[model samples]
Target: MLWRAISEELPGPKWAGLFAEYWPFYRKWWLKEGEPARPTYAECRRALKAHMPDLIPLYEDLCDQAGGGDLAARFLSFYCPPPYLSGCSQAVWGGKEPVMVRNYDYNTNAFDSLVLHTGWKGRRVMGTSDGLFGLVDGVNDAGLSISLTFGGRRVVGVGFGVPLILRYVLQTCETAEQAGEILARVPTHMSYNVTVLDRKRKYLTALMAPDRPAIITKAAVATNHQENVEWISHARFTATVERERYLLQRLRFHRDPEEKFINTFLKPPLYSHQFNAGFGTLYTAVYRPRKREMEHRWPGTVWHQKLDAFEEGSRNVLMPGIVA
Candidate 1:
């Protein structure tokens, strides 16, 4: 069962074309409806192709294997733009970033289990064309984990950006540190807070951008804004003050390692518009992948609810089984 669960199932050629078709609409929303000077499809494609040549071919191959083209057109009719504020700004017990946490149960050699909550949008591609967007959270085969938080800023530039960054981390890196290294060198067009967890369950790191150097701060907490890193502030001091305040408040609670924090936050009445609207935790997810040999709190029920919301808002099919 474990082997089957982790097995790699590639997609066909038609699926790859579907993914290509979806990019334009996905970019339209991400760049905010009619803002000019946004990166062109050719430019974004070029950047992705240049930086991740190996993965692009693999992605194409996966799409081809999964059967591509018309499947994407058929699904394209269902594609819905993701809502702007559809992300969470909550805590993860024993988490390193705002919405990411992992547990290593030494007693059971369980390796690891993780929970990743996200905002903005994320996608899952099998071969290429038939991929589904809006995945905000996922755990990797390596047991490393990741989640995203929003980062707003006045200053902007032109370069490889956020969605690609998320894809890069999930597709290539196997640990928090490796993801950090990738962020250190990549050029980003905007600011974002990316949190990563490693396989050993030993470290969590957040990488914020718009500056050359990266800060490796030690904390079990993070949120949708920037933290008070002196160098980061020195470079763009005035712009991120409000974001800093949010970050400070999120740090008030020391994450409790045993609590299944995200799950607790996502239950019932709390999962609806009242809580999500009031607190700005638009969506949440908790993924535990270690029960094959061990046990921990399971939030499958809560995640399914959030998944439904994501599907309704985006008009994209939810591929829960892919992640499962």
Candidate 2:
């Protein structure tokens, strides 16, 4: 798989090029159930204005850059987009430095595999990009970092996608407390567990769902599911319960060093190689909110990015179990 680190201060030719490259696949997925199945552009715009008014200008900018098309505008809104799911495990390491480590497990074919560094609307944000503008996991200049995991449930409802919610949080909020407010306020189309860590070492996990009010917890680790395992089949398939138990034990019982703690995610129970099953560990990310730095790690290789001096580059990763 190919991964890229792109630096663009704003939405411009670089972003437009990305749109042109990924639009075909996105358009097909957006219309998978036919155009009538999705909401109208009006509803999408309304939701964006209601929940994330601060991002409207940026959204419009990206929409125009995407050829000013109606479908592109609606897609960029990230409001009530088609329901998608991924297997992930994230946690806040409350050791010496405030760090957030996570393994993003998802279909390699469906993933963006892009790390975008942007200073848009005066906020410097860097992280894995999703849906063109949305973020899967990222850190802002304000010393706040966030990541998400699928809440093991099958319910899908009316709300914005969680990636956009993460993007909105990093764009506007500076602390975990502020992020909790937005996470609780924003309605999510599907259930997800979003964990936020600030430079001050404060962290919280918000269990958000469309059908229920968001539940805020001071939990350090978040695997799939919320509170309890609601989706038995999914839980078993993703080993959510096992993974959660393993992480909880590590955090509560074992006093592991910083490097040891981060390294655990690259091994069993966390690192996964079931690519043929559509959910493999694409990459493990470690974020140091206080330092404003992040690392993308595979088995042995690592790519680093820092807010102070960001670099644009690319790497070709050989997927596990694939003969090169």
Candidate 3:
């Protein structure tokens, strides 16, 4: 079902090829385990099968189109991991739903918001069917807010994959606690830190791994590295720590209407800070789900750019209701 959706909506052969390439990397990390017999790939697959069986055929179709050899190579490249860092900011405002903004900058330019939607059952089962789907940062009709950062060094074997996790969080969970419970129970393949905010704007939680979870009593923030977790230290994040600090400071001092906050500050024309290293900011985005009915503002609105094209220091003010 998920692959079918991709075949129906995306450019066929190219998308299928991409999916095949990434599948082995995904399977290797999630299925093969070492010391701690964490979550098994079989278990994760079963969970999706039981919860979202409709997507299996879709993935199979995509794999068949991609062939086997090319798919294997892509998997190897993905699992190797790269030394890159990404920084972003998200904000929620208006109505019961949450809005969001993010800056995705990396050494190698390979980012894409493949698709967007409002369903989870179809997605949870499909996993990373083709490319990433839905809003990497978004709010559901239920008014919950969610966003992510690659675990980088900390990511171990894969459990519930990132794309699937995002889809499940948006589709099934309604509050930060519920989202945390899902994160806590699942055996994760990679090391990722997810921040989930609820509708009332009263509660916020940051789930760092399968075992550690923390509550954010005040305004919350997350960078590429884990926060409040002991196994890692802030020092290890030296490469991108400044970027994270600048974002936190900006959010702390940010003063303006929600739209203005996103447009004037978050959207860019960013001032160079001492902490910034490597290619500044690739692209900045502000998404107010409630304000724009879950549509992404900026690049989607102004330049009609693909997410992979985002570069450091790129800035644009997006109009309302535009989508790729």
Per-residue lDDT of model 1, residues 216-304, tens digit only: 64454444345543435422422234333433343455333444444444443223222212232233434332210111222342223
Off by over 4 Å in 1: 1-8, 13-42, 59-87, 90-92, 95-135, 228-257, 267-280, 289-300, 304-324
Best by lDDT: 2
Cα lDDT over the full model 1 = 0.38
| Rank order (by TM-score, best first) | 2, 3, 1
Number of backbone-clashing residue pairs for each candidate, in the order shown: 24, 1, 16
For 1-324, candidate 2 gives per-residue lDDT tens digits of: 999999999899999999999999999988898898788999999988888999999999999999999999988888888889899999888888979999999988788899999999999999999987999999999999999999989999999999999999999999999999999999999999999999999999999999999999999999999998999998998999899989989888997888999999999899888788877899999999999999999988899999879999999987775432
Which tens-of-lDDT digit does each residue in 26-135 have in candidate 3? Answer: 44543355313433334434555654454445434433455544333233222222222344443334323454555444322234423333233332211112234323
Best by TM-score: 2
Residue pairs whose backbone atoms clash in candidate 2: 152-225
Weakest 10 consecutive residues, lDDT, candidate 1?
A: 104-113
C-alpha RMSD (angstroms) for model 1: 11.4
List residue ranges in candidate 2 displaced over 4 A. Answer: 322-324
Sort order, lDDT high to low: 2, 3, 1
TM-score of each: 0.55, 0.99, 0.56
